[model samples]
Target: MWYNQFRKIQKAGDLMGMTVNKELPLPADLKSEEPLTADIIALKQKRDREIRDIFTGASDKFAVIVGPCSADNEDSVCEYVSRLAKLNDSVSDRLVLIPRIYTNKPRTTGAGYKGMLHQPEPDKAPDLLAGIIAIRRMHIRAIKESGLTAADEMLYPENRSYLDDILSYEAIGARSVENQQHRLTASGMDIPAGMKNPTSGDFSVMLNSVTAAQSSHNFIYRGQDVTTDGNPLAHVILRGGVDKYGTCIPNYHYEDLMRLLAQYQKRELNNPAAVIDTNHSNSDKQFKEQLRIVSEVLHSRAYNSELKKLIKGVMIESYIEEGCQPIGSNRVYGKSITDPCLGWEDTRRLILKIAEEA
Candidate 1:
């Protein structure tokens, strides 16, 4: 195995209280090995534009970002997306379904599965090198076989370059939205980026993130100085919030939407919009409530023309089977190993309903 001799400052090993592992391949090397074909490249270009149009108000169709909470197994993920591709055709008229192939997840306590970046095989030990390749390969297969590029959370902003070409939409997770690096890095991307409100559910902090992502700036990234053109497609995602007492407080109601719209009007940000997360704090982890949550969001949109334009879409957590399980033996084929999901049957029914109404 080859390793880069990182400089002296890299010796933060002692300061950070962790051992240094071998360096992985550069983003370019990984792309070369698991390259996207010309046809796949063309597919992504077309799909990405459709997503951008939804946020820019140039298209009337809504965007539904759905799929597993964490893509732990490649075969299962591909199978899930293959089904989604077939479902997409039916709802293409009113909804643009962007599958969720989240490869990384944030743990409030900072333990457990860190996602495919730490353990490509959920039941196995951590292997950073293998994890990187696994995630890239899984993403490529999802696009090539399904003809649909998906959404992944930007948990590690520095690692986004590895899958930037393969992802149509990326979210700045609630845990990372307040970080300056995540905001600055988002400003340079061309794809649509959704900055979720922090766990505290503060709209001001969320709005500040949107403003920062929509403005150009200079910052050091990946060992070099750079400037960004600012992503006009950047926007907000209301995933609800958690209070000091750990209670889930949802913000997807009509009143919440109106309150957020008022907040957007107060800012100078471009492409003012929001995507309601049907899972998470919104559903309080009751994966089944995703259906009603989405319905409520659509209902709110229909109730107010002003809000109708502001609410571009929603994010749904779903998979082959419903619910989640602890990491161990005898796991369900399509069940989630991270957060619980809405499952396929419920997901299909909910999606079709969304198309008919949205």
Candidate 2:
């Protein structure tokens, strides 16, 4: 009988040995807690407004998104932002600064550092308590010291609430935007949220994410909440698509942008926008190519009027030094302890060049 055959396979370990993966407790539910201060709240609002204005073209200056490719040390992150703040003022009239304060990273394979949660040395799992504290504290320090808004990949949904009072912009990485949970989270986000195309770099998925983020929906939230008002600020970030060879390229061609534009038009997407990432698939993970990508964008803005207004901003992965070091290695410098980043000199040069071109 069919039942007997099924049972034979099950008993042979096809299904009998399966184990249910349990969901670990969120960081917020842990013991360590810190209430967001009024000052932080004010700063968050100010930063959000500034970013919105810049993205919508209400602000005269071009928006330049820059920060460490990935933050591994809290002190180094704060210090880097501090220097950026001083530079931001100089370019305030010509550019708006948005610091990358990403706490979570999406790895291609193997277990990579999940940010402050598994602090490098400690390597602790389910340390939700530490992760929350570290993220909130780092955000607070960056805001207080630099007065610049922070941008992060909203990899974990619950992490958003802990940073509600600090973050200005949230990015949905390529891997998660197509997920129902992420789209739902984007819908309810209080600030601007961006959705990247799928890992394979399919543009339609990005468009779908954009539409979903902007539409109101009834979804479960925080165990008791529902009714997502929709994320109006949700936009697309073209990090490039995989080719026949199955490689990540950071190339967002004019044709790609045009097709995306057409989709936005059909959806009646408000202030339809896109931000180009200079790293990841777009840059083919090459640090130098990132600089060229920005240059090309700036040049395109000057030569192509249609693209000038459409392409709103650029994202760069940069830090104090260039290249990346293996995390487990004992001898790493100020350079990205995570992904390889452009050196500070290269970053400064590119920013100044972009400013001049724009």
Candidate 3:
């Protein structure tokens, strides 16, 4: 009966998917091609430890994950990270700066420039095999130029092993937070994994995801069954949320922070923390509002001792130039091709201010 039903669907052409365009080398093979030296791996391990300390409340410095919204060009991304390396020294005592080298961007409609992982060149057609190699090279170069290991989104859970040795922090985006695979992958991560609240922005949903990530689980992964001991560093990132009407609902306010804190108290989460994304729905996509949002969050933290302890950091979108440009022949250099970002001048000033107060 089952075979007849399957034959019915198959014969009707319903039991099919898009054919595989090409077969690429496995992640291990790619890592071998563009390998990280033993020294680099050791340095990454140390960096990972320091980052873990900050999220676990062992370090008092506030973390700022700031950089371009999407890393499109290799030279430009490396150059931007180089600048951050210089600034890292200036605020090392008060802040731990983690540059965002997000290579895989999530598109709402499953179209447009997916990111460097899809189209290594923004305007060109996608070449996944070339894209895979391009992204790995860029990450390696960025770390070598600047002694800073950075952050990237685990946009595709299976694509993670490709950059596992490089990324210091992993973010589960607003759209993928409530997913089972994403939550499971976070548990097995050795680095900090920040899970953003879903687009609908239900606190219970976000908290539940966090709980799941921090608890042990036995699940199937990549053609094999695996058991995870859970990731204690898995936490929440409040990027604000959107309602059914597509209106952005801001959740980084003090009242909202208080509410989250109350919720955290009721749970047995480890190293309970939250990182506020100053852009996204929190700023309602008004890129310029990120500065004000960061200031307000810092103000709220200073006003409340509990908030100061629970809210560990922020995520800011910034680049060499402010605003964004569409992908075309006359695209501006260093400006975002995806989401609008804060220009360099304002980003520098904001970090200095944060260090002074935070």
> lDDT tens string, model 1, 292-311?
99999999999899999999
Distance from true location, Cα of 11 in model 2, Å: 30
TM-score of 2: 0.87
RMSD of each: 2.5, 6.0, 3.5
Compose the digit string of candidate 2's lDDT tens values, residues 46-151: 7778778765767656777788777777887888788788877777777777889888867778477767644533234545556667777788778888788788
TM-score of 3: 0.95
For all candidates, what are the clash counts? 1, 4, 0
Q: After superposition, how far is residue 76 of candidate 1 from its true place, in Å?
A: 0.5
TM-score of each: 0.96, 0.87, 0.95
RMSD of 2: 6.0
Say which prediction, candidate 1 or candidate 2, comes out ahead on lDDT: 1
Cα lDDT for residue 143, model 2?
Answer: 82
Q: lDDT score of model 1?
A: 0.92
42 Cα displacement, candidate 3 (Å): 1.9
Computed on alpha carbons, the lDDT of every model, listed in order, comes to 0.92, 0.76, 0.93
- Model 3 worst lDDT run, 10 consecutive residues: 11-20
lDDT of 1 at 155: 95
As for TM-score, the candidate ahead, 2 or 3, is 3
Can you tell me which runs of candidate 1 are displaced by over 4 Å? 1-16
| lDDT (Cα, tens digit) per residue for candidate 3, span 3-34 | 89865666665346834566678899999999
